[model samples]
Target: MTTRARASTMAVPAQRRLQSWIKQSRGYLFIAPAVIFLLVVMVYPLANVFVTSFTQIDTRERTQEYVGLDNYAALLDDSTLWNSVRNTVIFTAASVVLHLLIGGVLALLLNEQWLSAEVRNFTRGVLILPWLFSTAASALIWGLLYHPFGTLNYLLMSSGLASEPVEFLGDRALALMSLVLVNVWKTFPFYMVMILGGLQSIPVELYEVSRVDGAGRLQRFRHITLPMMRPVILAISTIDIITTFGHFDLVKLMTFGGPIRSTETIAYYVWQTGFRDVNFGYGAAISVMMVVVLSIGVLVYLRMFTAREQMYGETTTAL
Candidate 1:
């Protein structure tokens, strides 16, 4: 029972460990390609942007010099950056709120017991058409509608609502709201479809039981429907916030951040700064700032979700 016996015992365990490692490595092989792809496409570009943000780039000379936080510092005094930020917040908040309100109501109506299946299906299909169009396509269609010779102006003039063709996309005050309306129109259908799926997943028995207890439609909705749909609502709202906050294509196409840059969002500003103005370093800084803002927003939403759950728990306990 000396060195020979001890060495044999250790070798058996080491051999077993090797076999286990080999077994786990085989599973890792399947995911290795996906991991590499993400690193190449998403991670590398993200890291490059972060690096670029710290440097001053000369497009003419194809060179970069480390400038530390100068790019970010410059943003502090830039009135245009602040303006874009304010516009981005307004556009995102308005669009998300309207999407939720309109989508929720539409979902409830479509899920009504009195609605025939054919009518519901037809209405749903028609409503979802807006969401089917690509952003570029939506911009084109809305562009036509907002033009001086467009149907909207025609109707306003014919109905005596205006003495002239109202510049829907031309007026600075109306441009931002015009974009918001277009965004809401194009995106609410997605929220509606998501809420409808959540509604349908809810067990019918819950409604029956509530009705038997003399709960009215409003009561049932407050007690049962809302609680059940919370997850879907939270998910879709988070997505809407993130996407809407960084929205660019519509603004680019419809307004070009124009009317004295009234409709400029941070996203469009990044483009205007980088490609348009050839300030790649400053644009990268803006992009990094946007990521930070989006991260903070997601964290705040998650925090609210947690607090809501805790509040519900406390309420139940009290009840």
Candidate 2:
């Protein structure tokens, strides 16, 4: 090739390389802020927690003393920690199930065509009040309602619905359940809103076609509404389970894990260990365990949702 032609070819490659570099640099420039923010806000704190979990740090310590896995070992032998785990699981399970059931029912009720638009809107607005209130405020309000001589008990007594006032929050057997009820009351509205939004997005023609085919209400719900709402249900269930599992405010304010630690959730246990007992190292370990458990739950939820979507596709193809 001629010398000039060779020079032109080399220049073309150089120009292409420069253009590629510019594009790559622009991409990194767009992402750099988010990367820095996450490192500062999330990565650094998580790293500190991980480091602290392996040390014996407390109020008295200027520097954390490396204790290896002793904190984790102690947790294994701690009966109170086990009890907290059990309570956390129970609370999470009960709250998530009840929230889904109640919220699904409420969504169905509101989705009814016979309901006036204005009345439905008003009811939805009122339903969100519980969720709008602060968690501390909700806990306080519910705590009063659960009081032996509180308005709920008084009304029940006056109406002859109860033989006597029920010791809702004070009894060991009832404390966790009572907390679950309060949690459900405060959070189910959120699920209702999500499911209602999904319900609204569903094409009305499907329901109309089902009706024309002599499908009853139950049949329509089973075949149409439930199938269409599956994705939303899975999403909401995942969020509700995680939130309920880590719930601290309601349990802290209402029972303080009281009635003999009956409502001591994992989150509250972490708080107690870290702040109240000033055992920051052990608390960090527990927090790490919580992160693992919650991470597993979230992964499982995602897998389940994926499987459901695949099965739904197969069913649709089969039909």
Q: State the lDDT of candidate 2 residue by residue for 67-168, as single tens digits.
A: 999999998898998999999999999999999999989998898879999999999999988989888988889888989989999999999999998989
Candidate 1 structure lDDT: 0.93
TM-score of each: 0.92, 0.90
Give a tens-digit lDDT track for model 1, residues 1-319.
8899999999999999999999989888889999999999999999999999999999889999999999999989999999999999999999999999999999999999798999999999999999999999999999999999999999999999999988889999999999999999999999999999999999999999999999998999999999878878888888999999999999988999989988999999999999999999999999999999889988898678868967886222211
Clashes of each: 0, 0
Computed on alpha carbons, the lDDT of every model, listed in order, comes to 0.93, 0.89
Q: Assess the local accuracy of residue 186 in candidate 1 as a C-alpha lDDT between 0 and 100.
A: 94
Stretches off by above 4 angstroms in model 1 are: 1-17, 314-319
Which of the numbered candidates is closest to the native, going by highest lDDT? 1
